[model samples]
Target: MKTTFISTQAVSSATRLSIMKMQAELAKNSKELGSGRWADVGLELGNKTGRTVSLRQDFARLDSIKDTNGLVMSRLDGSQAALEGMLKMAQDFSASLIGVRTGDTGADVIQDDAKNNLQALIASLNTSIDGEYLFAGIDTDVRPVTDYYATPVVPGTGPKAAVDDAFLTAFGMAQNDPAVINITPAAMDAFLNGAFAAMFDPAAWTDPTTGWSSASDQNVRSRISTSELVDTSANANEAAFRKIAMAYTMVTEFASSNLSEGAYQTVIDKAAEIVGEAISSTTVVMARLGTAQERVKNANDRMDVQMKILNTHINDLELVDPYEAQTRVTALETQLDMAYALTARAQQLSLLNYL
Candidate 1:
């Protein structure tokens, strides 16, 4: 025991190592207190690392779904507004046609109104959001309708073109020809209920390249939730839109007081029937859209609740107790201050101090 003595260098090295260790711990405690999160999450939750990681991933997924749902809600809202506008316009046009008095002047004015409404209806059908056409089905990049006024309505392609072709093919006369007055009710009815009607048929709609089946009505769909998918878009080729197109095509292109009473009455009667059918079809579409919107909203609400719970779980896994961390930080600071004072004092002392 008398022969054993620790060297000065050894004492200094031991003191420096201890001070460095305390400083490292103090820095960690300070970080935990300042950031409100654990400084060493893996060390704190060693066995629960897998569970915490999974929870954080789930929380991230929920956030992404919420952002996507917001966009979907906006699109659905816009579609509802456009559909309602088209419905109101259809209803008004139908009402106007019921008691219309046909004179040269009145007929011309009616034609002008019909043309305007047809263009309006087309504009509504081509509604888009963020450069995505809402009525273009899976083909969102392509516009659903060509501009009625700008482009020539190609035969066998578009609504107006088909109507124009049908008028010529059925009566063997151009639209608004005086000879149309000689056409019988049976003939007019056959044409209206046959090929002219077929032109608007959803069953006949097809694209050569995409081959989007008309049987599905060409509505674009989106997966709104993990398990539920919804048709986010409306089909412009639906019965309601077609009926409005047909009526508008007739009044705008075929209205005439020069025709006999029978031919003029035929236009009025056919249009009224189609318009009535349109109102019914529109009501059904509205109901369907309303149901879809409700589904989207409900999913959003559920996800919101899930996100809050997930965030709490994630915090429990990664966050520090502020009071506990603050207490540790204070204690570490006091220890570090003492260690520095001792180290400084130790460095100033030497073996030849008491000569």
Candidate 2:
């Protein structure tokens, strides 16, 4: 040790290494100071890194679910609005039917209102948001209801055509036939309870070409939270819609003015009854949708709380003290400056200058 000699080259190499290390530390501290987070999270957390990783994953999952729940809530809101509008239409049409039944209004007024109501109903059920039909159940790509007033109405094709065929088949005559005037109330009732009712049955209503509804019976189900799933949509195939369609079709398609007073009153009475049932059924559907909306909102609230907690834990695991980081940065800059000065002085050293 007493005889040891150190060369300029060895001293220069050591200084260069020290300068590189100081530079790296300066950059790291600067980053930490700017971001207020660990410059190297894995290195800083080391053995605890897995905990932050898991927490981040959970946070991301909750965020994704919250976003999806937003879409679900939008769909539910649109459906509720559509159902409410349809309910109002049904109520108005029912009132008109009652007016006709009590002889306070003319039958023609009810017939015109029924036609308008049916068109409005079909339009409402076919409502879409973001190109997705709200009443299509799980078949979002398909239109839920057939337009009874759709132009170029072909025979044996579409809901209106099916109604026509059912009428002719049951009564052995067209709705506008002169013989309809002599038709008894019992015959009309039989037809209404039989062939007309069967048209809205699942098998017939689901027919691809001529059915009234192409929507699925199973509604859309959405995961509102990690552990909670709920129905987020309603289908046009519900019994309430079916009854409404029947009531509208009976008044709009039947030649009511051609019928005797007794048979005409029979139609009005039955249509009014069906409209009442439809309104009640629609109310139940709205109540169920309201419940789902409440659940989704609550789930979102809980997820928000969970996400906040997760963020706090992640911050604790990864955040750096800005003051400490700035102090380290200042120290590193001072050391780097000294190292640079020493290196510059060493490079200027020469035996020739001494000679």
Candidate 3:
């Protein structure tokens, strides 16, 4: 080939162009090494980094929901435990009446025994968790058991009456605001003189201290519940309580504390059945609670799965791939070194040097 010596200016220009191209390539490779992506994202999540961050945020939110579900389930489980204990107590009471007789128990003794159980039932109704009463109707702040006495009344409170002739009302019987007082239904009845009605009477409640007197204390909700607890003439827990109470009463009446085998058997059988009812009630509650627990667990499991998937997606979008990144880094380092050397050489270039 003919001698083709380029002018110094031309060589310098060519070197400058080459250096610029090399720098652009080096930047491209270095980016890939640092970010693990082949290219930059425009506006959309066209790149993995943006997508990964979104996935990570979603994962964290789902985990929080799962934790809340678990807490509710735990509270349900604790309530189940309390119910189980109540069942055992019911069973023991009935079992004592197998072959017992009324005469064997004292007249007053039967009433007293039932009263004690009623009190215990009241106690159970007052059960709470995390400071909230379980059976306080809509008012969870108050205890369920207020008293064993009578209904409360504001003085001179009359029956609800119509205000006009069109309304066919004579007078309005309105209770005072905050009318609810903590007195037993038995006692409240005496205050209101409402004790004569047999519905409010627990035949087994006859103690002079616990009698139908004005001294009773009870919550409004608890008072209302007393009617349900008392055995009605239609269907009564009275016989059940009465039978057991009588058995104990007889022990006092008779010199013998040992009940006859026949009597004991009868009492035991009744007691057993009552216990079964109590157990069934408790079991149903527990089963419902368990269902809630299951839901919580399922939520947690779902959250866990979701979080993992989100994490993986997030990783795909944001994580640097070590293998690709390292390769790019190596190439970039070489280009950077070459660029520095070329720049230095170009600066030193001269006509004499070429000669």
Candidate 4:
């Protein structure tokens, strides 16, 4: 028959091309397995690896967020501690006043104790973490109290017998009214010591001459409940009244023995009442601090949750799948072997069979 012989070369070439295409596909899927996502090569025919990659990245982010939660919790813990200290100190002072003997010795002893407690209290207010003051109200950059001099309690060094005005400044509050002590600390000390001239000492506290206006420093931190933030020119209101209400009671009650039941006797009771209110207000302050601590903890938890979701996503996107990769490798190896054997067999073929 007059017919052209078709070459085995053509058949083998077509088979090789088909095998190569399948091989390429297998390799791509294998990569996606190891990478935990499809690696789209932009070949017009295939690519679906985007989702896995995105999820894997998310997983990584979640892990980072979880780490941050620990730090946030630690900070909240510290803040809670500071607030508790303030409450405890205030409580003890109140209890002492409530149980005051109203005698000179009793008042004097109580005043001495108060002075020590106030020093400790101011130290607590200046508590800091990472060099940031916690009780500085809004002015955390500075210490809530200062050692302006070796003896801040000394007259002329600053206000006498008063919470260090420097402490007020550190918290960024203004006390332009320099007459805070009403009597120099030295003279007040002499009076407390029972010196006869203490009554006439210019430095000594005279209830009549001493200013009682809420504007005076005697009531500066009155509003100093936990939530009370003292600011520059912050009006002395119920807040400042709350802060020194206890101090007012101690001062007046001790002086009560000196003053007979007269016009100012009622004033002493009023001062005592004010101090009692301050103690009540301190309880409210503790509650507010507790709230702040809770809020900070909550915020940290939310961040942690978000991070977890991200971590899972990142893992899915980035990691390799051993089973799928192994399957692809095996399948591709088999196809390669089959194609090589077919090519070898084709090369040996010729027209010998036909002859």
lDDT of 3 by residue, 44-147 (tens): 25655556566667777676665645545544555555555555655555443332333445323433544566556545556676886554434556553434
Worst 10 residues of 4 by lDDT: 211-220
**What is every candidate's alpha-carbon RMSD to the true fold?**
3.5, 2.6, 15.1, 12.3
Candidate with the larger lDDT of 2 and 3? 2
**Candidate 4 CA-lDDT value:** 0.48
Worst 10 residues of 1 by lDDT: 207-216
lDDT string, candidate 1, 146-214, tens digits: 555554434345545556677788888977677877877677778777877675566544443222222
Against the true structure, candidate 3 has what lDDT?
0.44
Q: For model 3, state the Cα shift of residue 339 in Å.
A: 18
* Candidate 1 stretches greater than 4 Å from native: 1-16, 153-159, 176-181, 184-186, 203-218, 346-355
- Candidate No. with top TM-score: 2
Residue 88 of model 1 has an lDDT of 94
Whole-model alpha-carbon lDDT for candidate 1:
0.76
Clashes of each: 0, 0, 42, 26
Select the stronger candidate by TM-score from 3 and 4: 4
Q: Is candidate 1 or candidate 3 better by lDDT?
A: 1
> Which residue pairs of candidate 1 clash?
none
Clash count, candidate 4: 26
Worst 10 residues of 3 by lDDT: 158-167
